[model samples]
Target: NNRFTERNRCPADIEKNLEYITLIWLDENIDDSNESVQMQRLLYKMNNYVLLYTDPHLCIDYIKTIVDENIILIICASLHELVLPIIHSLNTVRAVFLTCNDHLKLTSVCSEYPKVAAICTDQQQLIKSIHGTIQSMSNQTMSFTLFDSNKQNSTRDSASILWYRLLIDILKTLPHTDQSKNEMLDKCAEFYRFNEAELQKIDMFRTSYTASKAIEWYTSECFLYKLLNKALRTEDIDLLYVFRFYIIDLYSQLELEHHKQFRINNNWDKLIVAISWASNFKR
Candidate 1:
């Protein structure tokens, strides 16, 4: 009865997600007790979509269905040897969290697979591992390419990096309305749904946020930080469209500061401007 509860849900579609990371846990006794439900509650807090399964086969089958989203797979230590080999090569599986009482002993087994992000002996450690893993992935280097008019032969990989830059440049030129901000807020409110803390942060954003303070709100690491980073990491066009209002704001503020720093310098020829796009942009 404690599963999912009535709050902290993104959308009902297991196949689709608004954010990037989808937390899937597989273990026969995953929800066998109230303690299990409490642990899941924490996972759901870290991510809106949390799926718990008892059957490993069902878990693997469902993971195969995921597209354009990163999966954080959680399993008991007992299942490590049996399940790790099967899902190790699946590109969708971003990070694996192994839960067991004797994680120290399982290190050698898990080290064989590069996707195994962490081995946690307890629920608290599991939560910490998941959060840290996602944060690290979100901070991964973005794709970048120097577009040279002199060089006519750019590979598809380089084209993608240039696309990110062009996309941002085009967005900065377009017009964003207040409705964009409201739409983004509405989506955030819906995704967070009944979560009190996130809703409170959203309310604060609505009441106090401004264009000039874009960097501040982003650095606050509130709901905006989480949502924005997830969409950019996955390159979810729909969510990014909703966030365009703030993206332009942030870029404009950055450019303003960038120019301000240049105006004080006499060496204009020596000046250089650098732009960095979003990540797990590493793809």
Candidate 2:
């Protein structure tokens, strides 16, 4: 019954595990008495902190190599919005600690992600809150025999699907130059670990297009709507026909005020060509 004894041991020794805290001090310029520094010193004394002195993006890269689950992420307010998306994308984080006192923003963020349990600006309270959160997460994990593969796989697959959907939407709508497109594609490959062949499948003609086309499309669409209003105002059936069957059908899209300016400028030839180009646009 030695195995049983070990398994049933009281006051479990979590120190034997890979459990640790990740403290990301985002701002390079911070006072000595700042909560980030104070919290860092407090966590350092606990001997459980892994101080990351890197930018949010690079820090995320380092964190990606860690396959541990008991990671408690403590990030500054500036890095919160930037790093949080990456953190949520991973299934490793057990809890989150923020060095922010903005109750309104914290309340909204906490509501969005329940794992964000504490938003502390004071050193003493931050330490206590962190310790308590770690303890609760540790206890919760103790009840489980091991990592839940099914849950992790589900989370990962769902995230991948959403990420892919977003990229595909970007490809269809958001216009980017070749350089930007290639960079985005490269990043996607790196993030998803896809090889060249696989990346090629997603690349298609989407990345080859120019941003000017997208801008023109948006401006044309806005212009068409603007012209449609004018057509209605002057009871111009011919103008309505030109818009319905030609202008809008031919030019692609614009912003509100800019669209007004474009309409006033009467760039009818450009609108026609844009609409024609859009009509010929292929996936």
Candidate 1 TM-score versus the reference: 0.72
The candidate maximizing TM-score is 1
Best by lDDT: 1
- How far in Å is the alpha carbon of 257 misplaced in model 2? 82
TM-score of each: 0.72, 0.40
> Model 1, range 1-283, lDDT digits (tens) per residue?
3344422222333435666678888777754467877887787777776787777776777777777678888888877778888888999899898888876688786569888888888777888889998777655523322444346266953555555566677666767877878998998998777577889999998998889888677666577766776666566777777888887787666566556755534321110112332221224
State the lDDT of candidate 2 residue by residue for 5-73, as single tens digits: 121122222122212334434443344445545545566444333444336765666556555435677
lDDT of model 2 at position 49: 33
Q: Which ten residues in a row have the lowest lDDT in candidate 1?
A: 267-276
lDDT of 1 at 95: 86
Off by over 4 Å in 2: 1-38, 47-49, 141-283
Clashes of 2: 12
